[model samples]
Target: MTDSLHDIPAVVNREGGALDGPNSLVDARVPAPIAPSGFDLLIDVRAVSVNPVDVKIRASANGNGTDRILGWDASGVVLAAGGDTHLFRPGDEVYYAGSLDRSGSYASQQLVDERIVGRKPRTLSHAEAAALPLTGITAWESLFDKLQLTGGSNGALLVIGAAGGVGSILIQLVKALTDVTVIATASRAESRAWVEQLGADIVLDHTNPDLARQILEVAPGGVDYAFTSQSRGRMALFTQVVRPFGQIVAIDDGRDLDFSALKDKSISWHWELMFTRPRYGWNLEAQHELLNSIADMVDAGRIRSTLTRVLSPLDATRLREAHAIIETGRAIGKVVVAAER
Candidate 1:
């Protein structure tokens, strides 16, 4: 580890508890972050976006004896690189979904692996760029990597929960690269319109049984691929709407699900966990490649940032408020906490 230049303030949880009370707030004496293994880059964090994982983990995650810092997606500048790092150097502006194994980016200074970081798109602000990494990676891997979707797929792509973080970005990705018509499910009027604005070819109400009916009216046989980013109870809906040999990819971790119901149609099931690469230390460089590729796409106008809101000051109060908004299940797009102004 290199010598510490300065200690930066960060949001921290000393006991790893709930977000409602004294447990959720800013801290002044939070230690500067460290990345002691595999690879490391000191990042001066500028902006960060909140996801359900942040709220869930903060409520339930345990820290190793010290307080646990919380954040995943960040847009920032590199300050230093560790010995094994070659992909980036000091002063490079980058964005990434950081590793779940260590301290996160809710700090002014953080250490992350170069392999999971990429240059920020020229067109986006730091907060906007910060919103893309986790959701973007999840959506991209779900469609192209997990579902194996391409331009030649024989049917439409059905996206469940089309207005949330991952779904919002996923809709845009499918619309941009694939020839497949996009069918998105959003129960609210605003969310429905949001997905359409993102280029969804059709929108259905996940709350209505008529959703399947509506989907069938447009796509008679069934969809070729289904990406579920929201409630896993919708897995049954996926079973009903996907054609034989169709693929189902879910990022939601619903429990006690019965896969036996899907046996007859031979529908394939896949779980998309964006942290898999960083978690198990497997092919860590792929995240860098993916983020860099996304930067190219964003710069080219093939995709846009999904950031819908920004909370300033990057402190615990704002972080908790952002988390509460998302937990309401009504946020139309990503919500970011910008660095101190």
Candidate 2:
């Protein structure tokens, strides 16, 4: 039997095109269907969402001598399953944030581990479902697994970068599942209004030099929880508004930290990397379970997909435009590419 991965059309960040700019993400074809091995599922991907990881990978692309697909979040139907796969069978509609080590989801067909995938939300289109996986997983883990927070936390929570994909979903998740007062930072008026509509109790300006003072004024005692990307150069201010014994979680890359500032208040620092489970083979099933729970939330109207923009045809040009929109640092929510039928 022919495998689904073979003979499928895909968008590739061309190898050795590191200098070619965003145009390097061209349409291409895989030479052969990659047979699924243990625990893998062969999927005919229907939709995919872009993130900063895709941009970073494309920018650093050195010729691997083959086209490198670069997308992580996708929704698709299983065309085949590995012999060891038990979570899903052929024809299952599923969604996931694919592992960082694997070829990504920007293809007509993809091979992903069954453990890391979940049944797609019945209430959502593939595009809508695709927008949730990466951001949903990150927000879920940041709140429950990393911050160990629940609906009863009732204290104030601060979210920096609250207009981006992760932040959009994070605010909704916190509002839906917790009683915490959300203070989100959005520098622009439109972004601030968007966050307000998303249920943030207060929206602060991120660019204000005395932003910490502002947050302190709003929360008074300090925020009990915060989630931010890139903690560098602003840890002192963050520490100022975070109460003693409060928690701060981050998802950015390596940066030097001055633990001494947070040390005085006994603040807990958490790092959320949604890829950690599958990257190191730890608790892969948790991702599957997490997405399932999110789907339930979506179906019940307790939450909504954060897909603010949807591009069509899924061509390289569309992808380039999507990447540009995201890079502008002004997008209020996720940008997804819906594959044409």
Count of clashing residue pairs in every prediction: 0, 3
TM-score, cand. 1: 0.94
> Per-residue alpha-carbon lDDT of model 2 for 1-341, expressed as tens digits?
23354466778876533424644688777754478989999998898999888877787746555668889999999999999999999888999999889888888888899998999999999999999999999999999999988868789989989988899999999999989899999989889988998899998898899898899999899999989975778798777999999999998774678877899899999899999999899989999999999999999998889988889988787888887787676888899998963
Worst 10 residues of 2 by lDDT: 14-23
| C-alpha RMSD by candidate, in order | 2.6, 2.6
The CA lDDT of each predicted structure is: 0.84, 0.87
Clash count for candidate 2 is 3
User: Which model scores highest in lDDT?
Assistant: 2
Compared with the true structure, the alpha-carbon lDDT of candidate 2 equals 0.87
Q: What is the lDDT of residue 298 in candidate 1?
A: 94
Tens-digit lDDT string for candidate 1 (124-165): 899999999999999989988898877766469888889999
Candidate 1 residue-wise lDDT at 306: 95
Span of 10 residues, lowest total lDDT, candidate 1:
1-10
Output the lDDT of residue 258, model 1.
Answer: 83
Clashing pairs in 2: 6-32, 6-33, 16-63
